[model samples]
Target: MATYPQEITLKVFVNKTKNCVDFVESDLDFVDVLLSFLTLRASLKCECGGDINTSVSYDLNRDDVNYEEFRGVFIKGAKFVVTDALCISLVEDLISTLNKCVNGDRNHMEVRLVKIKREQVLRILKRSLISDTPLTDVLLQNGEGITPKFSDSLAGKKVEKKVIDKEKKVCKLNMVLTRNKVLYAVASQDFVDLIFSFLTFPLGSLKKHLGSRFRMGCLNNLYGSAERLRSSGYMTAGCAERLLNPKLAPYFNCKNQVIGVEEEKEDLYYTCNGFCKLTALYFSCKSHGYSPYHESNQVTLVDPKSQLGGTISSHGSYCQKLMYMVTDELVVTPLSLESVVSFHNEIADPIKTAELSVTEAEILDVLAVALTSNTALTDAFLGTTVGVFTSVDVKGE
Candidate 1:
């Protein structure tokens, strides 16, 4: 429950020898902001900082936080110095340039304070993704430029229309193809619900589902190390589990999360210290009995959506019974004929279309593509190198 200021200050340690940022020192609030990257739903064709460690604990009562103590995970008064080794390359060039000109103390290390405002945090969150560096690639000296260039071999490729007649029908993606690339795809509610659920996924859950091969900077190493530590009995109870396979916060899960990320359930109950009346109305506490009138002892926990004495609506996250248009870049909007026509106009005369029925496996593939590539639809369907779902029943139109 830390209240973040409009601007948060970070103390960065620059190593002159390595020409990179050794780590960053900041309060818990800064870490909170950085952790928001895992919840991004859309893919932004931009670069960002780096993946951060998400295992730190926070105090619920802000007053109990010892600002004076220099803790192992987070330092207090002098700013929590976190050795965020991941994605240091993104800032190595800036550090290298500064190392040459800036004169510093004897330790071959320079300390600099960088102030970031809420505006910057919002901007970063708007464009942030889970696997890639959170810092923009433009900051690095040899950054892999944004929007990976499509290979020439993909040009003039065609995807023909296909239909699958099965006893159990699932959601389908009507993909518009121009040559080798997917111009866009028309997704139904079920598929769109799955995509929207990505925004609610925790970093740990994503890493767990994607597996260790899921490379996004140094996150794989960090997650792997945590797993090893946990099995070795080196980590605190529930620390590694929370960091490695975190469940979505309450009420974050949608109806069709084929990625298998689970949601956290709240089942805490509270009653009065002294029990007298209202014991018959509710379950009696084993120790203190039940006292609904005792306001001081009773703790009420209710779902925010169902506080008014009704169950949560069964409706999924997105609008119901609507078709959505999803671009290769993961831009999702309402499907319309005008937009479809405009997309068709962009493609040359030799345009082809494909209809694909996506099950859980294909949905998982889409999840993988969304995390790693900008051209999610194209890569999921047409990329020869990547594993494409070929066994799906396809009827020639």
Candidate 2:
């Protein structure tokens, strides 16, 4: 009656003698065929078979399902149950092979097995019936679910807790004082300005903004307080060289020098003992037994070395020479003028130099008119002097 005469067939038997029959099929359905084969051939023999009893052995030939060769056929949803069961065993073997790969025993045979198993699993999932379902869902329902290994989970949690505890510990100071010792060497105005600005700000504010240890380190290195007033153009090499000397207090007047107009004059002088060492010399002719208010008399100079090398006629030539030596020996080389000029020129606009030109005669005429009138020139050069003064002393010989 059927056109295709049931070409595929399967037979099931109860015993190894091939005498007893359990099931038989002519038009072999894929799942039925697999069940019949597994039960009859792949299954082991039993003396008293009720439902293929406990005493069973694996039939290698019949049990060996080449998943790669039949992956497409199994994935069509026609033999879903049998295909899934076969796939579970295949995946387990593949996972074992993968473990071997991780342990540095990556054999070609194991690699091929894993590849075949992966292809079969993918193929089965891609079939029309299973395509709509998630791979995770299928694995969870049929294969091993997403349960984590206890040892691995515990190790991970310990590592995470350790990391969190480390993060919770209080922060430690990690900065070094690089600029402290070097500040005296840097005498530029801009450099001094930067340092002074830092010092002038409140320590609490600085600590709050820049950190406590950093501010303390900077202050310790700076040495002097921020309240000290600096000299004009103090960033020059000369000023920087002087900063190395210690402070010195000058001597005052003796009893004889305290009378009349001499009382109004105060003797204040500075001495250089070397780097960052300065002393002020005070003299009083009235108290120290010296002559008062006399130009030619020797008043006994107390701090002759404090003069920083200027002529002292009252103290004679010998004292002058001694003072000069001390100052010269303590002198340090300042930053050169040429370097500052070069830096200034580098920052200035080249185009401004190219802009305007004026003749000397025109400048002189403009200045002459500016001096005589309260006109445009007066507004331009109101507080400024423009020319040099030449004095001619007439001497009759």
Candidate 3:
């Protein structure tokens, strides 16, 4: 069973002069809560925040993630501050004003500890997809509201088919279209693998791909602030670059990945002649900490999930070879005649059959639609919604 504390406390730095939050200081647990918002496949929830069930609905597979596994996802024992570029600038201004103050007045700032509940966490998760100021809307404003409707520009636009060159790879999909909306699609393992890969994508990586159109609540503004800080030399080393374009962790990349995002490769390391482990950058003896260590030959690690313990033929297929039926809302299951019939019974319009040969670009479009709209299949193909089917042409052997 899924479990979390009823409430977690945070110390927020409020600027009394501006009547806004200057920054927030919290332990790793609060950071963990923030990070959890990114990993969720939350499109399943109603945009109005009505149908959200935090315990089981967010977990794609109903498995309860234990504390040890959760710890591995983020670094522990670290106290971090959450603030944007604007807040940083405000702090700098405040410091300058204080330095020149005649009375040594420090009454403009105050810190207060606030309790955030599980319901608020859910609100933040939901608002992340809709509002750009989710923290302000939920924390400071104390409102559980959401922008349920997308922009009008996205709804009525026509989806033009991009011409594919001869060398471009494609995934073949059989779509059931009716009244200008895609009812469902019959996709093979290749396409199924692509959709399943969505779970592994980081929020920053998604922002990198989607650009200004990413529009996942405060995350867009957050990523943009990070970019400005990086350009202005406010960020140290490669921290900004890593945050802006994070690569997937090792072994998480799919073999048939259509998206152009990079993934971390399994690195081979060597030990010294003294049998001390060594990395490419740092060479320290395990016994004598920080001591110089000579490099030996590289040692290869076996793929844990591979068959026969050799080079894995396939690295990331979560399911077996089977035709899958994907609904517009992204409910994926094995394709069956019975399931198709049940779906067919939901509509009463004249249906049309079309085989969509989609390339990498179209697959990315599908990803974008899945994130932004509930009618993913329809928007990816037809770019609009309409009534359902009356007559159907069911294909068979």
Candidate 4:
């Protein structure tokens, strides 16, 4: 069930009458539950059907489902059909709600303590950096994983014919960006959290951010080919297309000094929509002008949603409301330390910071071991989240 829905929520109906709403874990498969959540058309089956062409509706947001409630909903929605984009959107929203709940909810939950060795954390960090795979994939592949375990696969479904995937599997990261410069990077929501985990110290301290500025040295594996990534909604339709050709590029300003915005009626494609924005936040920078530091260019980790449907500009506390700009949670530049200070000064809030230095140190260690020994990165949660008294620690970022 969605922990909290901003507006419309998943609803259910039986014979033109609203039944129950939101997520209810019944014997029914989760997907079937989602389909049943919708109000069925009149022609759909119903026990108390007054007419075959009528409909019923149902939605509820009371609290967690009880076993009894779960059983009933399961039986009722057993034969429900109709799975479409709406189901996908609801699922996406539900994912967000779960994140908020997991982060904030503590009621009726037991307290637990977890202690993780620095070595375990460092191992995972190094492996991802060296292999160019997302950290999650590194952790999941188990024992020197050579292939990415993160990409999804629809098993049993034959992929439709494709000109791109069928051709030589070109690693887009191999294309160096000289004539084409990146205006922005869009990461999905899960990626955002992963990047945050990397940027922030695992152990808690008073510090809010890791580091204000550092150079992005990894882009080879992270940059999904433009078209493939856009379909996921991290960016607009033309984003990858425009970048492929500099003359038509819409991301940058005329002088190529700044980025432009992709506007919609109310929603802006400035930042990522959600899901992978954080992961997308880290770019595999292959642009010609890519630099560790640019005196004139300033970078800030942007939370696109913070703007309240506003544009993104390189100004303000979180950042000035420029056009709808997509950004990851952190930004780095080769700009001088003074430039880094100036970049923070523009912001209105004093936030938690993470330092890239710690990550860099891990990278060094991992590279040393990898060169001589095929040491791969691996990590695991040392404790559970269900607890009343929870203690968190950091190994010093």
Candidate 5:
């Protein structure tokens, strides 16, 4: 077996509080204790058969920690850098010490160690070695280490390689989308577009418009063109919309409702709508394993009345009026009584329509997670018969 050098670099962020004062205060002394522990734990043998190289540095200015603070730790200034085999050892020792302190079961009198960097070890070695001798030569001569070697047969060999074309991999990812996934895709997008597209209509107008195959075809064509532009990384949905439907671009603003006017408020509505529409179109195209512009594929439907409760004329004008009157209350309401009655009679009359679709989905998700933890179930299912049982009994007399 060939061995390779494993160089690990880590940043330790220690916040000193009333609870953590012991670890931060008397920093150098605490660090020495930590270095001693790490030197043993890491099994870092020094070239000169002496103690492992390590260093300590501190910063006292306490400020709020944010993403910028993290960036500043490396960019603006680093408190310290230590490079040596013992660096990882020191980190492990400090973490163990802190874990014990936080847990409260361990004795507070136990010597607490502070973490140091691996770079510090290398710096110490570089300075200690003779100026004329190379660092690698010094370490090797002192019995520290040498480069590992692998057999030529193992190191270099010709094998079949599989290349995942992004175009194809993206297509595979799309195949995971089902109708429910499509709905999620839509919701994840710009809410403003959804409101404008579905809410402003004469209640059911949006549904009626969207439910039609012809309107769907138009959307598919438009989305297909947009997808091509997007795949080429040339234009975004808003950009494409402006390029293709320049006339409609003026009406695209949901908030201001005025052309050639810019507002201080972000155009969240339109931005959201564009994102939703683009995402839905992208996933729909991907699911079918085809480019959005594929001539044979159809546009995915967005059923506003079914998905989002709006006034549907078939549910009756009286019912529609009731919906508007009780819109706030109906927001939390279950699908309407009329719709429920219509569903049982008109949709699934003879068929036993149990609401197990959601349950089935949940079961599938659980199974996926379980399979990751327990491989036996997967192995058993591969070659054996596993019967699926139903809760409901069919005792036909």
Candidate 6:
């Protein structure tokens, strides 16, 4: 019985014309050796500066590769220059030659193992290497890196390893962070918003140039968790606790005492793409294979007790708001409140009318200190001084 020849299409792009040429796969595939086709001396004129042809074959043991000679990378399935016409002829001839040779003979054909160009190799002595260069730049005199023939297998692996992995977690740095390099700022609305904006560019930057490369978290644990993340190529910035001024404590208690556990984490994912700073931490912690929080601080914040005493109460409770603008802005019209609650129950449960004032200078002083001081906003920023869970959990994932 006789069998019909099987056909498979192989696509190749002509550099000069930016057009594709398809050939039968078996006709074009390198069966025994590539030199068989190089013997044809097909000169392909590419848009690149020099000629592209696969005539230069380097032997690993005998050949000393001057960096100039080894133009492209040595990855599998890497392409070299062959003229459009030459490539066409090789395919035709190869098919014809295969028609005569025993089918199993090609499999048994042996050649010295020259090199695996694209691999992770370690040198016993010394070698300098640049990665992911295109064949056009290598074989062709001035071959551009953008030749369609370049197969970016290494590039794909790089992204999978470095970029994609980073996006999946909050990074704990391999390097140590010092106090001087540590910046602890209260989670002002601007900073909270910055965290939100950072999330918008989880895998990439929203605007080119310098993209956001940090995570967001409540200012609750800046000294511990957030700092670790920031030092290790990650930023987990968020709101600080309360602005602990004796005069402002009562008003702050009224403004920020509504924060609860669920709302604390909801901010991270409210507008984010299903990821939060904790989500990143969750991944990073999981990867470490040990619970970093297992031996960590107790996860709770008692109610914020005012130094002035009895005048303020609401510790252990989450802040009602991340930050309240206690500083005043001048208003021409007298504002009327539908309802106002005073700290003193004896004065009345609700005050029908309310009056408030803060000078521009006072406003600037309070906000500047709150936004700048690392310690002022801790109570309000993070209700739990530490964290709730001992470590990251998949939660059904």
User: Candidate 1: lDDT over CA atoms?
Assistant: 0.53
Q: Give the TM-score of each candidate.
A: 0.56, 0.12, 0.62, 0.16, 0.16, 0.15
The residue-by-residue lDDT of candidate 4 on 202-243, one tens digit each, is: 101101111111111121111222222335443333433332
**Candidate 2 Cα RMSD after full superposition onto the native fold (Å):** 42.8
lDDT per residue, candidate 5, 1-397, as tens digits?
A: 9943323222322222322223233212222322232112111212322333322233323333342234221022112222212121123335666576557634332333333244433432332222222221222233244332211111122211223233111000001111111101111112222222222221112212222211212222223433343455434234432222222211222322211111122122211222333332343333334444432322333222232554322111111212211111112122356643443354221222111111222212222222112231222121111122233322211
lDDT tens readout by residue for model 3, 299-345: 66554445454575336466678999988887899999999989878
lDDT of 2: 0.23
lDDT tens digits, residues 1-397, model 1?
A: 8965455666666666765555665565554444334332222323232322232233222445564452323111323333433322123324554455455534777777666655455433433333233333212222344542222222233222223344233488877665567777888878887877665666657778866324354444345545654465444444555667777666666665665676676444545556333333454654553345444344554444333565564333555668899998888889998997787666654555667767665566567656656687876676432234333322222
Best by TM-score: 3
Winner by TM-score between candidate 6 and candidate 2: 6
What local lDDT does model 3 show for residue 1?
Answer: 100
lDDT per model, in order? 0.53, 0.23, 0.60, 0.25, 0.25, 0.22
- List ranges where model 5 is wrong by over 4 Å: 1-217, 223-238, 241-348, 356-397
- Could you tell me the lDDT of residue 104 within candidate 6? 40
Q: Candidate 3 clash total?
A: 6
- Full candidate order by TM-score, most accurate first: 3, 1, 4, 5, 6, 2
> Which ranges of candidate 4 are over 4 A from the true structure?
1-29, 32-148, 151-334, 337-397
Give me the displacement of residue 392 in model 4, in angstroms. Answer: 46
Most accurate candidate by lDDT:
3
- Per-residue lDDT over 1-397 for candidate 6, one digit per residue giving the tens place of the 0 to 100 score: 9943322122322233322221223111221122121111111111111211231223233133342233322111222222222221223335555444324444443222112221111110001011122222322222223422212222112111113322222111111011111112222332233222221111111111111111111111112322232344222122111110001122122222111111122111111222222332343333323444432222323335333333333332222224322211100111112111112222312212111121222222222223223232221222222233223321211
Q: In terms of TM-score, which candidate is stronger, 1 or 5?
A: 1
Better of 2 and 5 by TM-score: 5
- Model 2: CA > 4 A from native: 1-299, 302-310, 313-338, 350-397
Error of 2 at 283 (Å): 15
